[model samples]
Target: MNDIDAWVWWLVGAAALGIPLVVTAMPEFGMFAVGAVAGAIVAGLGFGAVAQVLVFIVVSVALIAVVRPIAARHSAQRPQLATGVDALRGKQAVVLERVDGSGGRIKLAGEIWSARALDSDRTYEVGQAVDVVEIEGATAIVI
Candidate 1:
């Protein structure tokens, strides 16, 4: 331990941290790897062991604090994008069959979907264009 160079250890640590980043695809491991590389630079510059460790800790913590929140914000932005049936709402559909209160069919977003009129008494004839009001189960409610 005394004979081996501290910079070598730091480089090894950096490689260790990088493995998890590759395997798990977690950005934090990459941040830690960068920190380890910073520590290696300090060690290669002939800094003392304590100073090298301190540099590693400060770099790692700073990177995590600064970058984690930004990453979280970007990831959280996904909810603003609609998906699945939620995406179907407010989209236009063409009635493939007479749509009434009971049940019918419509071509929605290039796919066939079971449909029902938004108003119980209102009926839509075949080829009529209607707006999807909402999705209930596998059916699209339209007007």
Candidate 2:
């Protein structure tokens, strides 16, 4: 924006931010509002029509720069990490091999995944009751 527009922008920002702060802060500083108007007037005459416009633009830019990241961070927190194993969390899969405490294979969907028991694999038949405990790297720990 041109200097005139920028100066006006600065004026608006100052007024908006100042009004709320002043009204809540002292309530007696009615002088602040009057001073703002007077300052705008004096600034307009001394700096020409362009000063307010330039100030406004600068204030707007600074505000935007400061607030943008906070907004993005708030949004980012909404959805950050995936389910599990980077993809599959509580998904069902067939037992490709008898899982012991060590490791075995689970056939989930059409893909085969390595798996192991969460605790102990004392007696786990090739085809028996099992649950996907956790997924690590390219493997799924099962029980």
Best by lDDT: 1
Q: Listing every candidate in turn, what is its Cα RMSD in Å to the true structure after a full C-alpha superposition? A: 3.0, 11.7
The C-alpha lDDT values of all candidates are: 0.95, 0.62
Worst 10 residues of 2 by lDDT: 26-35
lDDT tens digits, residue span 69-135, model 2:
6766886785566754645666667777887778788886468878887777364667675667677
The per-residue C-alpha lDDT of model 2 at residue 121 equals: 35
Candidate 1: tens digits of C-alpha lDDT, residues 2-109:
898989999999999999999999999999999999999999999998999899999999999999999999887868779999888999999999999999999999
Off by over 4 Å in 1: 18-29, 79-87
